[model samples]
Target: MKTKLLLLSAISALMFVSSCSSDDDTITPSIPELEALELSNCSSGIAEGETLILENRNNGVDYIINCTYPVNGDLIIDPGVTIQFGTDATIRVYNSGSIQALGTAQNKVVFTGEDKVPGSWKGLYIISSDVKNKIEYATIEYAGAVGDDGAILLWSDTHLKMNNTNITNSQTYGLHANTNNNELILENNTITACKAPMYLDASYVSAISNGSYTGNNTDAIIVDRGFIDEDHTWTKLNVPYHFPNGVDVVAGGNLTVMPGVIMKFGQDSRLFINEGASGPKPSIIAVGTAAEPIVFTSIDNVMSAWRGIYFDSPNALNEIGFATIENASNPDQEGAIETWYGTVLNVHDVTFKDIQNCAIHQYKFPADPDTLTRSNLTYINVANAFCQN
Candidate 1:
């Protein structure tokens, strides 16, 4: 019995020792607290297959992205997140990376600079990202240090959908589309306080609905390349089209202005139609009715605020019916309507008023008088009715 009791006690002791050793071998790793980390020691670039989630800490420290790095993974920023950037530090999204920053109206995700000044940091750059990147109910301000591409640069086949966002106080352009394949969708956004609010080719803009472009130094939309390939009609709903830099209808392009379309031009702005080379000749068919005529005027209502339209193709078809042109024809520039290279123009039921120069100026007159067709043309407050060069 004594040996039995001693053996039992030895077995119990061995079991207890083995249990303690097993517990020691299986240890729980310590997780460092985010509050304990110094801001200087924060990581700069986000690596592949890694996700960076920014939570709302009550602390006043602003998370800073130190350098320009391509985001290969995901960046999920929570609401009320304020991210300050280092000098020229841009968040570049490339190689199928995505950013899902869905903030509320009250708690918006802000992308600003460390100094909180205009043009302080480079803006968000989305390049060649096939994923669905979205930024909603956020505030992007004080950017535009990257280049002439504006504060929010969308480049190289990126699909960025922005809604209910406020982009203001940019140095050059508020939203600049550099590439032709950018599928940008803007809804209920307010873009203001920049040299130009939106700079894009008219072809790449997907949608512009319920947006306001006010307080801009230049025009509302600065179309870099105004080449309309197919037949385009500007209706009354898209009225008040402000063109600060003017538009050029390239060769093999056709633009048709419908009735009740108002075109407002800026200072020294003029519309040019290029001569065709091989394909069908470019044409501008601005047809308006007597009740609802197409109106072309200046933005500030200043006389001669813009130079008028110029046609350069002789073989191109040009027609202006029931149109009213006001505040055009500067004395130093050409007339309200000038045709070059023996291009013929037909003006019917058209009225040209407040003209600083001639209402119609034809350079190198055509062989036939019927080439410059006119019917019921009215000139009010005009300097010169017709001038031949």
Candidate 2:
């Protein structure tokens, strides 16, 4: 009996040891902390032959980039890096300098101001024409100081490939591309809480995919000044083009507005379609379907919020069909669709609503009324259907 009891006790102890080994195998390992790097005596700007690799800097000191001399080297920032800027501090990249801040999906680089308020620090300026500049998975906030270019300013003829970046809380424009040849490749970027999310010339935009502009104080996208020199089409996939300062179709430019596109104009803003000096006269072909019509309205949705669309000596190819012109037309001036210098406009199947003045106004009528094809014109709450001067 004693031998059998001892055998049972030995088997129980073996079972207990096996259970302990199995539990140890299933235990999760603790993750290691990120190593911090010290940036104590870093100066204002990064000069030539210097490379700045910003790691985890949780210190309270701010990095000021005065840019006394142009940058000519690489400023590489790793993932999970945070940079705080001093008052009116700006990092200007010039002389073919480049910045490669490639962050991962889980880790992101950040740039903010000392006060953590909008307009506290000057933003990043890329004045170099180098195409090697890139920023991905980063958060740039609380920028737009006085005399500074927007949060991310591109003054040179460079191409910036930005992906999964967030630019917010800017006192002025979120991303301002001033140069004509500055191309932007934007994808999955969220720009919000700024005066203007994007202040760019529409012609300079290379490509945009999954870009979000929301909660901006003023216009979402302000087209600063450039003629669309190519055959461009604004589709429904990119709707609600908020133009605070208005856009002009200069000579040799052609703009086609697709169906179901919403164009919001700011106060006193107008879409000026100017005549070409030599080449094919600039024209606007805004044709929409019955089910999906193009809408041109004021941003505030108030009466006479904008100056309306002005066709300054447009060509015969210009046409406005299946469109809705609303909240346009000053009570003291011309109407929503104005033709200047006897410019014959083709209007068909178009609706004019909430117009303060006439639905269509012309400086002078065509010799024959039929010269301006006005068919299926639906007018509602308009002071006058047609006004001729």
The list of candidate 2 runs beyond 4 A from truth reads 1-45, 48-70, 202-209, 235-239, 289-292, 313-317, 331-333, 341-345, 363-371
What are the RMSD figures for all models against the true structure? 10.7, 5.9
| Candidate 1 C-alpha lDDT tens digits along 86-149 | 7777788776677767779988888777777778887888774555588888888888884745
Least accurate 10 contiguous residues by lDDT in model 1? 33-42
User: Where does candidate 1 clash, by residue pair?
Assistant: none
Screening candidate 2 with a backbone cut-off below 3 angstroms (N, C-alpha, C), the clashing residue pairs are 44-65
Model 2 C-alpha lDDT per residue in residues 302-379, reported as the tens digit of each score: 888988888875478789999999988885448798877746579999999998888888776446343456899998
Residue ranges of candidate 1 with Cα displaced over 4 Å: 1-62, 73-81, 104-107, 129-131, 146-149, 156-158, 178-181, 202-207, 230-245, 256-269, 285-306, 312-323, 330-334, 339-350, 362-378, 386-389
TM-score of each: 0.68, 0.76
